[model samples]
Target: MIDEQDEFDEFSEAGEAEMDENKGLYEHVNITVDPKQEPLRIDKFLQNFRQNSSRNKISQTCRAGNVVVNGQIVKQNYRVKPGDQISLLLAHPPRLNVIVPQDIPVNIVYEDDDLVVVDKEPGMVVHPGFGNWDKTLVNALAFHFEKNGSKSDLDRVGLVHRIDKDTSGLLVIAKNEYALSFLAKQFFERKTRRLYWAFVWGNMKEDEGTITGHIGRHPKNRMQMHTYTDGSQGKHAVTHYKVLERFKYMTWVECKLETGRTHQIRAHFKHIGHTLFNDERYEGHTPLRGVNLPKYKQFIKNVFDILPRHALHAHTLGFIHPTTKQDLYFESSMPHDMADAVKKWRNYLEN
Candidate 1:
């Protein structure tokens, strides 16, 4: 049986609904309609083909051009014929293996009987999936529990939310099932507060504004998320931003999400033509809104060297404690690389 880990082609379709989804790697599955197969709508065919898939998901995949029949992109209603070849591409490869515990160090912010909060560093994936089975935060959590004389099966468990592998920030892990359920309910109901800080390109006309759009995986660009203004294509998302500081060409902003769809902040800001600084996936490295002088270009390159990844950080998270029922808030200082990059920009303004 073809599973989530099956390697797929670059005709990318859709990604995880969550923003913290990993890379653009997709799983391709080929389905050959039997010679005796009856003519059926492509959407219906795919639903029968993958029982685990939903009808709405197939419809979105078709719109994204992930469904190909005999080498042609077809709409959801296109009829499938006998002896036809169909190729499918989907994103966010599912969990392929169990998470293995490692002795990796984790900076725990708080820990108790029900949950633990950690200040996750950059480049550390939140959980296990294809290509990353160990050294994840969950792996470290497993060791944390074991070292404390407790062993728990954390495979796909205890996580209430996730941050991108390259986006450093804070995350809360449920140590017990009750905590997971309670915390998850808060997140799903939009009761938790999350604040992300980003240094992006372009100056804003307004000091603060709200960005409302639907977020989904890019149809053609496999590595980036896309924002849909029409709301017919993706999940509804809202991001509120306030300018924290403004440089000659770039702006540092704080974002709060009403709906945490995949790449909500990145995609929403990109929709307004203000991509994040150093966000390679979204063309932040390119000169989108600045002068093209050689000296200015070289300065941007120097900034990129100091901060190699996207300038985004999960700085604050607030939610009611699952056990104590008390309101709790946690904050993390910006990482050194991003802080250093900000400092360089500041000094450039002076010099």
Candidate 2:
């Protein structure tokens, strides 16, 4: 649930890495003047694309030499012409909390000058947020950097994408500005590939299918996402899924994200009547499928105890290297708890 947030809050999350144009801040934007673009003031041109951005903020950034056009810092009134490469590095909003280094253990898969790849375990929040102040993945990354004497101003330690606290999986962390910008672009453009493995409550009839809906904050419940099937509201989101295996009343599936909307896979599946197994937030813990006998109910409870959290895992992540331009792929096996629950279901089927 990395991208699950209010629409306005999304801008607060940093995506840009270090670029020659921007002073290496979290707020960065890159735009190329179109061939048919008429000569317009730089600030006005940016305002057209950035509706929430204010002219005063744009002016301040231009004056601070954070607006680069054709490799040169330009004033707010500079005329943007066709074929111009424009980059903006806006100031980061005020920090709410001071990030302190904590000696938390993390499973680092790969590390280099530009970035670090990690295989995150279940129950570890990726970054500090409301009710999650310490012992997060960012705290561990901070400690790792402090121990190595690597000083940086990057916020959230350059996390490009994140999984939910209960979801276990792989993540890529940028160590430098260039890598962050490069990876963020790939994610924003939907070029990176992410695969998740999940066990849902009901047996899916289709071998494979795509779920299309607009995902946004629930009107009544602010914590959850509401899927708009009519394309009337919310941002566009798509999830593609294929059935991998089936139990008596549950199914295992592989999910590929076409768009990284918050709670997209969970919400989209629920829209089609297949809530993820053990997903307490979406009422997946209820006996939505299977027999109504007391023994069957007890078995479901036992399985829930075995897998307390939702039965979902970020199985694999693939992206193009920021520096090398080569394809990079990472995979993590299912966590023990989820695998054990699957085994339990298999045993029940045999019996």
Q: Which candidate is the best by TM-score?
A: 2
* Candidate 2 C-alpha lDDT tens digits along 1-351: 011112222321222111111112246567778889999998898887677766665665565456788788788899989889887654432233777889999998888777888988888877766667778888898899888877544463376666777778888887754566567556655678789999998879999999999987678876567789988877798899999999858999999987777677788888899999988877898876547544788888899998998888889888888668889999999889989988988888787
Model 1 local distance difference test score? 0.75
Q: Model 2 off-target regions past 4 Å? A: 1-96, 151-157, 289-294
Q: Per-prediction TM-score, please? A: 0.73, 0.77
Model 1 C-alpha lDDT per residue in residues 1-351, reported as the tens digit of each score = 233343311212232122443233244678778888899999998899888866765776676566778899888899989888888765332333666669998999988887888999888877765556567888898888888975445753467677777788988877654565456546655688889999989878789999998777788985677888897776777899999999868899999988766677888888998998888778888765447544777788898988888889999989998768899999999999989988998888787
Error of 1 at 197 (Å): 0.4
CA shift of 2, model 2, Å: 28
